[model samples]
Structures are given as structure tokens and as C-alpha cells.
Target chain A: MANQDFVGIPSQVDTRALNRGASDFQRLRRGLLFNYLILGAGAILMIVPFIWMISTSFKPQAETVSFPPRLFPINPTISNYIDVFDRANMGRLYWNTTFISVIKTVFNIYTSALLGYIFGKFVFRGRDVIFYILLSTWIIPFEVYLIPLYLMTVQVGLANTYTALIVPEIFTIYAMFMFRQFMYTIPTELIDAARIDGAGEWYIFHRIIIPLSKAALFTLIAFYFMWNWNDFLWPLVVIADQDKYVITVGLATFVGEYWSQYGVIMAGASLAIIPILALFIAVQRFIIEGVVLTGLKG
Target chain B: MIQTIAQKFTGRRSTLRAAEHRFIVIALVPTIIFYAIVKFYPIFFSFFISMHEWSLFGNVSPYVGFDNYALLAKDSLFYKVMWNTMYRTFAGTFLGAFCSLIVALILNPIKRGSILLRLIYFLPVMTSVIASATIWKWMLQTRFGLLNQLLSYVGIQPVAWLQSTTWAMPSIIVMGIWGGIGFTVIIYLAGLKGIPKDYYEAAEIDGASSIQLALKITLPLLKPVVSFVLITGVIGGFSGGFQAIYMMTGGGPLDSTRVLALHIYDYAFQRMFMGQASSMSFVLFAIVLILTLVQFKLQRVDWEL
Candidate 1:
């Protein structure tokens, strides 16, 4: 049960005004004003923590815990931001997270698209059997496998390594399912036409199919990258080395270490949050639509 | 290439068919192998682990044969944890769903600044749960927290939010709603989009008030989406909250905030009780499976995976 998420405003308001008297129009207008008031207050509630985060990030230690809860700092400082980088190895954390996320997202998307194309576009014996079998794994909670997966990582001697981070998750079920869904949109004529034109099967998938899948690609990339970047439990379990820590894992430990250092902690939180939020906001239209496309409700 | 062509002719397999077969085998073989090793095998292995008194550091894991599951049955703390998990799941899901539905219903008819308003709502959704939890913990701090400070101005006493057992779970549930309402609002918005405008217009022409129209036309039509949200929300709630709970309370003040997911992580990782944790995870799996089955029955669920 899905539809285009952003339909134009429901037209009943206008219709009611046209059908009824001026009193109705006046009432509707007042209702609209009331809606705005409620929405405005809710929006403020929605963003206050973020504003407070940014505000507290800039404040000095004294101001962070000050009486009356200062919304604006009496004295702002960059020292906390500096401390996050210096003590928490925030740069290294960023690099580690970005690198791992990029690798994982690429693996996740590319493999998913390929398999999705195969399962969707190509008909072969046992294809549905294989796909549904794989898809069934989607419902199994990650916790069900967490203990065994960790032990397997240790058994394979991949523990405390980034490969431990990426290898086990190179193929993801959800994205693959989405790509499979996206595959139905791509016409088979394109594949057969390319086949008639003497393009190799792999070449068709790469040059024709993948290029055609940019719509699904961008959305999956944005989401998978964000999810991977923010992944914590696995990295927390596997990567014991601080240098190898992803940003989420790094921030978790950093918060625990500096729990009392309010400004510095907020600075760390701000840095961790700002990158992904900016990335999403920039390409948000696609994601919002992609949510409709994928039925990926968070 | 010549040999392949000859074999294709001899074997009655067309060249394109051969290529397609090759491509599929190339794609599927690895997928099958990967799922078997990583997905299917680990589930079985985890189940196997649950049947024993297992620890990674310990060499000898004497097979306990449902002893771990039995331990959960007898343990008072496990019962407490179960209660907490249900409390969090139902409270968070229902409250979050209700709030988002209201927002979506209101936000649906707006003709101005809708995107900006939606984006503002979605800010917390995009932020990492851990990061959101971090900010939330600060705001909910006992003395210096913003929530307490705000309460002071209203002449209410400063209450311990995350530190008090009574307040901790509610505080967490509220935070969960705040963090998730934007997302659920989007879902409800999409759901609202599905209901045709004709019904509303018809109701309005029949002299039905706005509230009546919502109660009659909109609510009835949106039943499936409401169920979808509730069902998925409950399912996710079973396995969710590890990150937020981990960061904020660490399942503390009195284990009041300890949900199953966090308990599993704590037992498996922190306490080195892997076997017991695995059993708890199976319990979670059973719960999720049952709810998912209900979702499937309630909704068409086609292409929703």
C-alpha cells in the first residue's frame, strides 16, 4: 500500500470553500492558521535538540552547565572541537567510517543490482527458489546471528580488522530486494535489443542495465552509506583498535570517556551528525521519493 | 570460443542460452555460497550455541539442552527485562504512531512550505540514533539538563529523568517518539496520499464537518497503513533500541531500561554469556516471527520486503 509520498495538497479545502458560503471560507482560513501554529511549534520541538547541540558545541565548559540553561553561550570556544579531534582521533574515525561505508555500500549496491537483475530480468532454473531463500533471511533479526557471527569472525582471524567490518556484510538482503523491485521497471526489450545488437551478456548488464538503474542506484547508495557510516555494534565488537574505529563506535567511547565534558562531547556529537545530515539534505528529494519507491519506512 | 560454439551445437544449447546460463551460475553460485556461509549457517550456529553453556573464552561448553532458555524462565531479572521490552515497544510504537498520524494528517493539506516543514521534522530521523541519544542524554541530565531547567521555570520540581527507574523508561519512550515521529509521519503522509480526495469532498458536500470527514472517510481508508505502521513498528521495536539504550542508560538506574536486544548484547559481549544471550535472541526471533506473520495476514505485504 504505497503511493507518491508528496501529492499536491488535498483539494477538499478548496472544494469546500467553493461549494459553501463565506463563513465556511473564513472557518477554513482560521483552521489553516491553527494548523500552521501547531506545525510551527512542533517543528521547533523537532529541531531544538539540534540547535541546542550546535549551541552547546560552541559554548565554553562553564556555560554548558550554566543556570537558566543558556541558549547562547556567553563565551564561545573552538577548543572542544579541537579536543574531539586530538583526543578521540576524530579525523581517523571519519576516514575509517567513510572508507568502510563506501566499500560496504558499493559492495551492497553493486552485488544487489547484479543479483537483482539476474533474479528479476533473467529467468533460469531455481532462480525464484534461490531468491526467496535469500530473501527469507531478511526477517531474521541480526541479534539471532550476532553471537555466532562474532565467533566466526574470530575463528577466521578477521577480528580487529576492517575486513571483519565489511566482508560479512558485502551482500545485503534489503538493498538487493529493492534492486530486484527496481528491476521490474527496466524493460526486457532493452536487454534483448542489446543481445540482438551483439552486446555480450555481462556487457549488457554493465553498460546498459547498470546505467539504466541510476534512479535506484542513487537512493540505495545514500541510504546504505548512511546506515554503514552509523553502524556501531559490529565495529564495537570486532574492531578493538581505536585507529580502526568507525565514527559511531569512536563517538560512543568518546562520550563515555568525556561524559562530564559537556561542550567537548557536544562538539564530538555535532561533528559526527553534521556530515551525514548534510549529505542527506543535499540529495533529500531522491531519498524521500526512494522511501516511496522502496517502502523503506526508516 | 570455437570449442564453446561446437559444444553449444552438440549439446543443443543456443549460444545466448549458454551465455545466460553462465551469467546466472556466475551470479547465483556466489550468492548461494555467501548466504549459506554468512546467513543460513550463522543462524544454525547461533541456535547450536544456545543449546550449550558457551563462552568464547571458555574451551569447554557443556551442552545444556534448553537449560539457557529455562534459565530465562526462572530468572526474575529476565522477566523484568521482558516487561521493560514490552513497555518500551508498545508505548513507543503507539505513541509514536499516534503523534506521527496527527502530524501527517495536519501536514497533508498544507499548500505552503510543506517541504521545509517535512525536512525539519526529518532532521532527527537522519541523525544517527547513537548521536541523537547522546544529545538526548545531555538534555535529560538530572540537574544541568535542559528539560529540568525548563521544568524549573514552570515551577515544577527537577526530576531525575534517566536516573530514576520510574521516569527512565518513559523518558526513553518519549525520546524514541521524538527521534522517530518524522519517519512515521512520512509513512503516514504516504498513506494519506493513497486516500482519494473524492471521498472527503463527498463527505463535505453531505454537510459532514472536517472532524467528521476525518473520522469517517480518512480514518477508515487509512486503516491498512495504520496497521502497517503498528505491525512494523512493533516488529522493529523487538530488535531495536540497542543503540539508544546503550548510550543513554546502559540498561540501568535499575535494569528498568533493559530491553531484550540490549540484554542480548550485554550478556554475549559484556558478560561473556554467549549461550544465554543466544537463547534470548531466539526468544526475540520467535516474537518477531509471530508479529511478522500477523503483518502478512493483516496486509497484502506484496513487494514490501
Candidate 2:
């Protein structure tokens, strides 16, 4: 009787209920097929340029600029990569870029975390107002601040030094906001417990907060590094010395030095991308998740 | 009299609050100094410099005040640059967002190869712009370039992409989308992941078609993400698009690719019109603020998350 009732109910609910189930399965299958097709198509389109870059970088000068371009570097060579270092002082460029990116990343993570801690855990006077003011700074595009920042950098004798780059990048509201969001999810009772256990505020931040927030901190680290690594404008403006130019400017200038040779420039570009691509692969989960939530909230 | 007595007795609690306040202030000192030096000081100083005629060779010639602002409005190049900038921003944002969203939606349903696909889509975002832009510039070469080669296979003539004024800005837009769509796809993929599967199941039970579900449910739920992408798209479009433009065209072929940021870069660095450049920066700032506020207002209607 129970089995009969179930069959009867399904039949009576809608005349084509069973057909609907079949159609649903069909839709799912069609969706799966369509998704894979599009995904494969998208993957090819997105990665072709990168593959082209790598291939062209290894091609000989004539082959690189050849019409009906060769899909592969018919005769692969590392001379272009070698030329970048031998001709362009690629070592100094790498050092300069690494210096700015590393210092900026460290400063941004530390300072932004501390600010996030205060904003998240403390009930200070005008806290909301201060947070709002800080958030508002995100709306002020860097262009608006460039001229004045340049002047100040000149006045303080920090122009052409790495200090001008690292100092100004320290207080990123986007990073601060990310930290605060992560911090908010942490239970306040944990902080109260730390304080009750004779932990100083600094100690709590160091011991309790920093360790627990590694994911968010790592995300910010990756973000700041990428930003500073590829940054051109500020470095172009403030750091005018040939010896001080970062990898970006170096690559740009490299193109000029070997204007006729596309292979060498491509080689340098491929080298420049290696570190970031490696970082992206290693920390992709954190970054993609962080990017999505942060993009939406921001 | 009773209230006064009560307040006096509670003075000790207030004292503790003040102590806590001091600790909080002490903790925030580093951030305060950072903001003052990095953000606020530069902003005010930029305004100050825009009122003066200055140069890179340590000369603050004189305060010309509105003279710089007045001349900027009369400048034909200023209008041309501003219009080009608007075109780039709109075209980049629209095309990037649309393609990324569509591709992301299609890719979202695949249970297999999703991670690898995401990585591939995100590769460009991870790669440095100058590196990729240089490669793209070569590909777009009018003669003997990769794109033209491919176009020839289709029985079409190769067009001068970046050299012609008609094609220059659109060429940038196309490259901008190629470099940019990856980030948007990654972002949209994340947004899609956050959506619960139950909504689709319920929609299915209601006899709602797939397209219907996407429009009626998926889009509305994705509004917050859309608003976010749109705003950042505009912001990034205006500010960071300068890199690719600078590298590829140098605002070339008769200043067809000259954006406002590039304009500021030229005036300040090349021509040494510090006041006019600073004024241009402020104008860009104003446009960003107004556009952002308008978007903020529009998003308030259906506050999707």
C-alpha cells in the first residue's frame, strides 16, 4: 500500500513529473558538456599569449619577427636570457625590484595587521569614524597623490631611493580591510582570555593574532609583492637613476636597448613572470577566495 | 542631587575607560603616522603645487592659481585625452566584465578541470603587465604579425591595429580585456562558488528553465559582485590602464591613445607643466569620486551579497 501510494502521488502531482526528472538529468548533462567546452576554449585563449611569449623568447631574431609566425621556437636558445643579464644588468634590476617588493610587503603586512587589530578588537573613542576615514582613502586614486608625493619625496631627499616606494605603500586600506574582516571572524573572547592571562596588548597581537591570521597575512603578502614588483609609474617618477630601476623599468628600457630584437625582450619578460606565477600556483586557494570576497565587499 | 551623586560614584569606571582609550590610541599610532605621511600630506601638497608653476629642476617659479586650471579647460588635447580615457574605461570595463562573467558561468558547472581552468584564466593576472603587453604588441603588428597571419587564413586583409587612429583605442581595449579578463573570471568564479546549490534545485522543482534561473536568481544574487567589479573596473580602467597604453603605444600615432593619466605623465615629466598636470590629476579624482558615489547609490536599491 505504501509503495502504491508513492507512485500514485508522483503521477498525480503532474502528468509529466517523471518526464521532468528525465529532462532535468538531460539538462545537467548538457550543462556539463557546455561547461567543459567553454572551459577548454577559455583555457586555450588565456594561455596562448603566455606560450607565445615563452616560444618567441627562445626564437632567433629573424624567426621572432618572421611573418606567418612560427608556433614554436624551431631552434630554442637561451642567448636572449643571457643577453638580458650581460647587456642590461638584469641582476641589479632584480635586486632593486626584490628590495622594494619585499620591504613593502613586510611593512604593509605588519602595519595593516596592527591597525586591523585595533579596529577589530578595541572599543576606542571615535573608532568607527576613524575606520571610515581610512576606508575613504581607498577612493583617492594614486594619480591624485602622485604630484605631491613626488614633491615630498624630493624635499625629503628620498627621491631615487627605495624609501620613497616602501614608505608610501605601507598603509593600504584594502589590506587593512582584509585583515579586519578576518579579525572580526575571530572570537573576541579569545582576546579577552589573552588579556586576562596577563598578556599585554602587543603580546596578544604578536602571539594570538598574527599566528592565527597566517592565511590573510599570506594573501596580503602575495598581493603587495605582486603590486610592487610590477609597479612602474612611481618608480619611474621617483627613482630616476639607471642603476635603481626595477625589473619593470629595466624590461621597458631593455626593449629600447634591443629595439630590433623581440626575442631578448620576450626572454626577459618570461624571467620576470616566473616568480609571480610560482607564487600564484602555491597560494592560489587563499588568493582566489580572498580576491572574490574582497572584490565583492570592497 | 541624586543624579550628581550617582555620576560621582561611577567616576572610577570612566577612569578605566580613559585608560583603555589611551592603550587603543597608542596601538594606532603607527597607522596614523603612515596615513599622514603617505596619503594626506601628498594630497594637500598636490593641491598646493597645482597652484604654482614648477619644474623638475628644483624651481617653484610662481603661484599662478586658477591660471593653470583655466588653461586646462581651454586645452584641446585635454578634452581629447579625457574622451579617450572615457572610451578606454567603458570599453575595457564592459567587455572584460561581460566576457569574464559569461566564461566563468559556463566554467562553474564543470566538476572536472575547474582548478586547472581557473589557473589558466588567472595566469595573465599573475603575469606582469609589461611582460604580457610587450608580447601582445608584437602580435598586433600590422605586417608580418601573428594576428594578421591568422586573419589571412580567413581570407581577410590585415588591418593596422595600433597605428590607425580608428583602431588604436579599440586595439588597446582589446588587449586590456585580454590581460584583464582573467582577474575578473577568477573573481566571478569565487562569487559563483559562494552561491548555494539549493537555489538551483528549488528553481528546478518550480519548473523554471535554466536561462530563467540564471536571470531571475543568479544575476540578482550576483549584483554585489557586479557592482564591485564595475567600480574597480572603472577605477582600474582610469588609473592602471596607463601601463599597457604607455608600453604599447606611448599614446602614439598622433596621440590617439593619450589617456588622462598618460596626459598627466607627459605634462609633468615631458613638458614640465606641473600645475596643469596636477589640475588634471584632480579632475580625474573628481570623476572617480562622482562615478563611485553614483554606483554606491544605485547598488543600495537591492543590496545583494
Candidate 3:
């Protein structure tokens, strides 16, 4: 960092610039070091729960309640995981959840795109009214919908069925709203251009609009997938059969039943968490950027 | 930007041809019907259910107009639950906002491995609340919890975090912050991204310190996003915490951790007091609706002050 080896007489301005450059360099380094220490500590705090959960999952039952806790197991084992599968029907939970989440997400995204396209692109009577009505429903909390929706499910003979799980949530508003906003970015001229080419409406949607909407599409897909995967409340209220349980409900019940069995329960938690986390981490770049993108538009 | 485009759509409605009109009708008609049945009708039916003595098994459900709401007004436990809900909502939202702002401020400056840092922070946000609460419950465990073990290094004794009435709500609130901070941080970061770097460079040329730069340059500009996070966070907080509380404490330790969501679920499902639960949900609905209106009004006010 030394600049004392200058061959000729340095101009006053050059010395000031050099001094400022060195100070700026030091300041930048200081800022980076501060960031590392503070953010590093914060990041560790954030993941400690996950690390502990994973660590506990590998521990023996006896070690779980031991006086002095160990971050890593002295004798790591997979017994807790086996116990989760054996006792909690973790595989069935995974299958049921996957089936439900996939269907629900598909329905949610597709319907929202269609409706959003209609509202955002089309010029029709009462479009704004209809769109705003649907948008307004976004404010109503799911808690308000829980009881009556459950009762309605039973009344319609859809109770305890996968239909109950997916039907009530088929037309989600938030994603639809997002799609509608995203639709604005698609020029009206494109639709008009397609129309002039004698392209069918659905053709334009499938070939053009859908393809053009990859940005919002991927982001909303990632988010809704995660939300559907982690959804606990509605599923918990509607599905009562033990075999029909989703992962969140299964985990809740598992934790309740195995309240004191820290190791196996943590294993169950791990099983419930890992697939979604893995999926998220894989597509995380899209998600993080998508959040920033939608955060503004939303 | 959104306003202008939306206004353009209003002022200049495209002349619809038969096929385009059909497409619009076909897509929207069923969706409107779906919304009416699934979303709108439920509110009315829930109101209807609220005015009666309803249950899962009983057949002789008698109508009792306004009684459920009246009952809630008088019930001490309902009051406690309201207090708990407000306590959790305000504490969780505000604290989470503050922490996220700080994290985002510190985080926005770093160029290297920022994504990794964000990913680590967002770990819990991706994890199911039930799973997060399970891990939190174990960590807050009195005998073998990680928290107590860590606290012991400073000569602090083991505290029954979920068992003590005093500590239980705070514990849940802290957990709420943990589950939520990453999300709000992303919002703040996005807002931070909107700010042009020229303001900072100009201010720095005038010898503004980092703290002053943050206060004078960053915060004032970031007000809209800050309030957005706080408003949305508070709104969500009212109806949230069910999965977490259900897993962690089950509204126990003297119902200290009980919020409106948990209480509503408990009454309807466990106790079969569907009428009362519906009424409580109405209360929640009103609170959320009011907050939303307030949000709208706040947004309308130019964020100058």
C-alpha cells in the first residue's frame, strides 16, 4: 500500500488523491469487516435452529435430554429417522402433501394467470369491478374462512377428500393480482399484433403471453409452491383422517405425540422441512430476485 | 407508474372483438363464481353461523343473534386472548421490522456473498412454521434446551421458556421475529435498491458520517417501504402464529400464548363452539380490514413527514 517510491515530484493534487485513495481503501475494508462480523453473527443466529434440528435428528434419544448438550452426536445414528418413518408414517405424509401441494399450486397459478390476463389485458365491461372485488378478498384473513369453509366442505360431501383441499383454494387472489400487474408489462400491441395474424386467443396466451411471463411466472411459482408446501391451517382443519394428513399436520401431531422424544421429533421435523428447503435453495436466485421484483410491483 | 398504466386502461378501453370478448368472459365468469362461493359466501355464512349455537354433532342448533359477539365482549378469556393477540402482533411486527431494517442496511453494503447471507437468513422463512416452532420448542426446552445451555455460560439458570406465563409470549414473539425478519429484510433491501447512489455520494462530499447518511438519506427515502413492511407484517401477524403456537405451547402455560387465531381454532375444532369461534374470526376480520384502510390512507398521504 506504500506510495513513497514515486520517482518524480508528486503534484499536490496527486498526493491528496493518493491519500484519499488509501483512506477510502481502509474505509472499504473496515466496512467489509464490519459487515462480515455483524452479518456473519446474524446469519449464524438465523440458522442455529436448523442446524440444531438436523443435529438433534442424528442424536440418540438418551443424548437428546442429556444435561450437557452436544452440538454433534458422539455416536451419530439414523435411528431417529427410522423411528419417524415407523411411528409417524412420514412417507405417507410426504406423498399426501406432495400430491396436495402440486395440485393446489397448479390450480392456483393457472387460474390466476387466466384471470389476471383477462383483467389486465382485456377491455370489457365490469372488468375493474370484478378485479377489484377479487382483489379486496385478499385482505380477509384465512381464519375468517376456516369455519364456514369446513362446514361447507362437509355439507357438500367433500369433507375428508382431496377435493376439499384443492377446491376452496383454486382461485387465489394475490398471485392473480401479481399476474395482473405483470400483464401490464406485456404491450397491448403484442396482443393486437397476434390478433392481426389471425391467431386464436388461447393460442396467443399459450404461445406468447405465457412464454413472455416467465419472469413473474417463475417467481410466483416458487413462492406459491413454498406457501402451499408449508400450508398448515386449512389442511389441518379439513383433513381429519390420519392417513390423509399433510406434512405440517403430521409434524404437528408427531410433535404433540412425541413431545418429550426430542430426537425422533426433530427427525420428523427434518423430513417435513428438507424437500422444500432443497427446492428453494436450488431456485433461490430466482426467488430472491423475484421477491425484489415483485416487492416493488406489489 | 402503475397509476398511469391503470388510468390508461380506464380512459382507453380496447374495443373487444367476439373472440377476445369470449376469452375474457370464459376465463372470468367461473373465477367470479368461484370467488363468490369460496371467498365471499363464506364470510356471510360465517356471520350466519356466528348468530347461532352451532356444533359438529348437535342437531338442535338454536339461533342466538348477537349473543356470540356479546359473549366475546364479556368473556374474560376472550379479553385475555385479545390482549395476547395485540401484544404478539405489535411486538412481533415492530421488532421484526427494526431488526430487518438494520440487517438490510448492514447487508446492502456488502458486495461479496450477499446472496449466501440472504439465503442463510431466509432459511426459517422457507421452513414451515410448524417445523420452525418444533425446532424452537426444543431450543427453548428447560432441561435440555439450547437457549438455557447457552445462557448458563453467563451463570443464568434454566428458565422454563414455554411454561412460564411471563416468558412464554415473549419467547413466541422472539420466535415470530426469527421466522419473519428475512422477509422484511428483503423488502427493505428492495427499497434500498430504489435509492440512487448519487444522494449518498453528494451527502458524503459534504462530510456526512455513515450514521447521518443513514438517518438523513436512507431512512427518509425508505419510509414507504418501511411502513409497507410494518403494515403488512402487522396485518399478517393478527391471523398468523396459529401453526407456531399450536406446535410450541398449544395455548398453554395459563393461556398466555393464546392469540385470537389459536383461540378461534380451539373453540371451533376442539370445543365445537363454532358460533363463538366465528364471532372471534369476525373480530379478526374487522381488525385486518381497518388496518388495511389505514394503510391505504397512509399511502395516500405523501410520505414527507
Candidate 4:
């Protein structure tokens, strides 16, 4: 029954009842065939752009601009990729992005989980008031705070630095709230048992709570990494030096600088997408779970 | 005698409670401080900056109370940007949510390859906006584009998708829907899973067609999910137009696709009009807050039904 819930299909009993007669069975099969045809076609439409992206990345410059553009390159080459790496400082861009993404993801997950553990497990003075204040911050979009944050960064003399990129992104109210929701499901008895064993609060948290909340932790890590990796606007606003640019910022500026270099632009884009696509495939299930938890709860 | 005993026990318990409270404070200190400095402070500062004649390189700017707001009221570009923002928000939200719901309903009945299909659909959401926008820009190119090539087979004229003022916003909307529908479909699928099968069975016994079962049972039950998608979609649509616009069109072809977020970006960063940009940000914030609250209030009424 639980499996049925997850798969979201009719139960065997319902199916058997519906498939009583030969004509009904045939009609059911026909309906399913129709559904598959529509779904398959839609899937093709969804997948084609990505396929086109990869194909374009491999195409020579001439083929990229050829009239009535071909879906597949007539004579594919690695020259575009070579040009992107050689001139675009692709390596530096990757390093800057990876360093920021890793540090930000680690700090964000740890802080959010710590706050969530406290909010979920402890009864402290002004807890509700504090939590609600944190919740209210989620309503204030980044655009509202962007200029002041830039000013604040400048005042602190951190503008155009990695500190500017990483610090402001380390704490998110949504991640904290998500961890709190996950922590609520953990049984209180486990904590009580640890307390009875005379474990310190920090010890209990590190040894017991952290290990038990692995799923939520992984979810947060994957999401935060992707977000920081792909973030453009703040990076664009704050970082002026090309050497410090993240992948998205680098790619965007590259396009602006060389708008007519279609093959090179496609190559850079392909390289930018590969890491995220790999991450998605590796943790695809958890990504879906995270989206369901966040989206449905909204 | 019993009162004294109870008092002794309570006194010891209160000490433990105090210890736990201290622990909570210790655990939460970093998060709270970070939020205070980074999140809370900036919100108040944004409001403060909106009231001043601020610029990029100044220690202080003279107060110009509501002058920026007044300027915005008379600014024609601000109104045009707001209209663009509204157009994208409504059109994107409606199309994305409606298409996702339909896709989810169709996928819910299929047992084979459903997971793979869902993953394929979600590829765009996983992709970086820069890359996706780049691909879209290429595909939407006037003469040498793939979309135009495909349309030619059906005898349709080649359209300058991202080049023309009239077509640019719709092009952005198409990309927005394509990128957004996957996540919404996943949410709707979850909602569909939560619906009890007994309702469908009962409806089928009563000779309810698939369409009737969907309209009467599925749609009503999915109200919460629909409302959730709509509110988030609106918020994302309003605030999240910057990346796509920046990468694909840069508010392009005569600023026809320049949304309010991009407008603020231009004023604050490009033109260095910090005060005016701050004012615009507040206006955008106000609109979003009202829309969100109205959605929640309406959803509450819907739930009561």
C-alpha cells in the first residue's frame, strides 16, 4: 500500500475489477498506449534542447552559423572546447566556484542543522519569538537587501573578495526550517537516553543527532552546493575582477565579450552544465525528496 | 510536609531546565548572529538607504525623504518594468502550474519508465541558468536558429524570437515555463500520490469517466498543492527574472523584457543610483508581500470549503 502511494497508480484490485472483460482490457491497453505516446513526445521536447546544446558545443564555427542550422554538426571538432579553455580562464573559474560552493555549503549545512536541533529539541526562553523572526526574514527577497548588503560588504572592506561571495550565503532561513522539520520526526527518547548516559549536549548532538539526520544533511548539502555554484546576480554585482569570477559569471561575461563566437559560447556552457548534471544524477533521489518536502509544504 | 518535598523536586528540575536553556543559546548563537548581521541588518538598511540620496562611493548621503519614491512615481521606465514583471509573473505562473498539473496527472497512471521520464523532464531545472539561456539564445537566433528551421517545415515564417521587442518577452516566458515545469510536476505528483485510491475506485463504480474523476476528485483535492505552486511561482517569477534577462537578452531589444528586478539592478549597479534602486526594491517587496498574503488568505478560504 505504501509503495502504491509512492508510485501513484491504481491498486491491483482496482485494476483487476476494471479489466474484467476482453473489450475492457483492450480499451485499457489502448488508453495506456495513448498516454505513453503523449508522454514520450513530451519527453522528447524536453530533452531536445540539452541534446542541441551538446551537439552545438562540438560543432565547428562554420557549422554553428550555417543557414538552416543542422541538429548534428556535419564535422564535429574539439576546437571550440580548446578555445574556451585556453582563452576563457576556465580552470580559474572552476576553482573559484568550487572553493566558494564547498565552503558555503559546509558552513550553511552545519549552522542550519545546529539551529534546527536547538529549535526542535530544546525549550528555551523566547524560542517561538526568535524562530518567527527568522521565518519572517524569508519573506524579504534578496533584491530588497542587495544594495545594503553590497554597502555592508564595502564598509567591511570585503568587496570583490571571496569573503563577500561566501559569508553572506552561509545562513539561510529556509534550510534551517527544513532541518527543523526533519528533526521533529526524530524520537525524543533517543536524546533522553543520551542525556541519561551523562553525555554533554555537544557530544549528544555530534554523536547522535548528526548521524541520525544524514538524509536531511545530504539534502541540504546538495541544494546549497548547487545554489552557490549557479548563483550569478550577487557575484556579478560584487565581483568586478575577471580572475575571481564564478563559472556562471564567467560564462555570461564571455558571451557578452564574444557574442558572435557561437561555438565557443556553447562549449563554455556545456562545461558549466556538466558538473551540476553530474551532481543531479548522483543524488537525484534526494533532490526529488527535498523538492517534494519544500514544495508541498509551501 | 508534602509542599516542601514538591518544592525541593521542582527546584532541582528548574536547574536542569536552566542548563538546557543555556545549551540552546550556545547552539544557536552563530546562526542568530549571522542572521542579525547579514539578513536582519540589511533589511533595515535598505529602507534607510531608500530615504537618502546615496551613491556608490560615499560615507554618507544627505537625506532626501521620499524624493526617490516621488521620482519613481513619475518615472515612465519604472512603470514599464513593473508591467513587464507582472506579465511574466502571471503568464509564467499560470502556464507552468497548469502544464505541470496535466503532466503529473498523465504520468501518475504510467508504471513503466515514469521515474526516468520525470528525471528527463527535470534536466532543465538542474541546469545552470547561464548555460540554458545561452542555448536558448542560439536556438532563438533569427536566420540560423533551430526553432525557425523546425517551423519552416510547417510553412511558418521565421520569427526573430529574441531580436524583436514583441517576441522577446514571450521567448523569455517560454524558457521560464520550460525550466519551471519540472519542479512543479514533481510537487503535483506528490499531491497525486497523497490522494486516496478509494475515491477513484468509488467514482469509477459510479460510472465516472476519467475526465470526470479528474475534475471532481483530483482537482478539488489538489487545491493545496495548486495554491502552493502559484504562490511560489509568483514570488520566483517576480524576483528571479534577473538571471534569465541578464544572460539571454540583457533586458534587450529596447528594454521590452526588462523586469523590475533588472530595473533595480541597472539603477543600483550600472547607473549608481543607490537611493532610487533601494526605493524600487521596497516597492517590489511591498507588491510581493501583499500578493503572498492575499494568496494565503484565499487558500484558507479554499481549504475551509
For model 4, how does the per-residue alpha-carbon lDDT over B153-247 read when each residue is reduced to its tens digit?
88999999888999999999989888877777877877787788799889888999989988999999999889888887887677767888888
The residue pairs that clash in candidate 3, if any, are none
Q: Order the candidate numbers by TM-score, best to worst.
A: 1, 3, 4, 2
Ranking by DockQ: 1, 4, 3, 2
iRMSD for each candidate structure, in the order shown: 6.3, 12.8, 12.8, 7.1
Error of 2 at B208 (Å): 3.3
- C-alpha displacement of A290 in model 2, angstroms? 10
lDDT of 4 at B74: 99
Instruction: Put down candidate 2 lDDT per residue, B1-305, tens digits, no spaces.
Output: 56544653565446545655666777677677778778787788888878888787765469898788899889998888888998999888988899988987786665445667767876777677788788888778787567888899999899999899999899889877877776777677667756776899899899998789889888888878887788778866776577788888999889999998889988988898777899889888888888778867866633111
Model 2 spans > 4 angstroms off: A1-28, A285-298, B1-23, B58-60, B193-196, B301-305
Per-prediction DockQ: 0.44, 0.33, 0.38, 0.42
lDDT of 3 by residue, A189-249 (tens): 9887676655788999989999877767876777778888888888888888999999998
Q: How do the residues B1-305 of candidate 3 rate in per-residue lDDT, one tens digit apiece?
A: 57545644563335337678778778877887888899899999999999999999868789999999999989999999999998999999899999999999998876656778888888888888889999999999998999998899889989999999999999999998998787777777767877887898899889998999999999999999888888877888888788888888999899999999999999999999999899999999999999989988888743112
Decide which is better by lDDT, 3 or 4: 3
lDDT (0-100) at residue B33 of candidate 1? 92
Error of 2 at A255 (Å): 1.2
Off by over 4 Å in 1: A1-30, A286-298, B1-13
Q: At residue B167, give the lDDT of candidate 3.
A: 96
- Grade the docking of candidate 2: acceptable
**Which lDDT tens digits does candidate 4 get at residues A1-298?**
0000011111111122223355445545648778778888989989888888888889888888786667778898999999999888999999999998899888888888888888888776798789889877776778998899999998899999999988887777777777777776679988876655456778888999998777677766776787778888889888999999999999998888877778888899999999988987888666455444434343
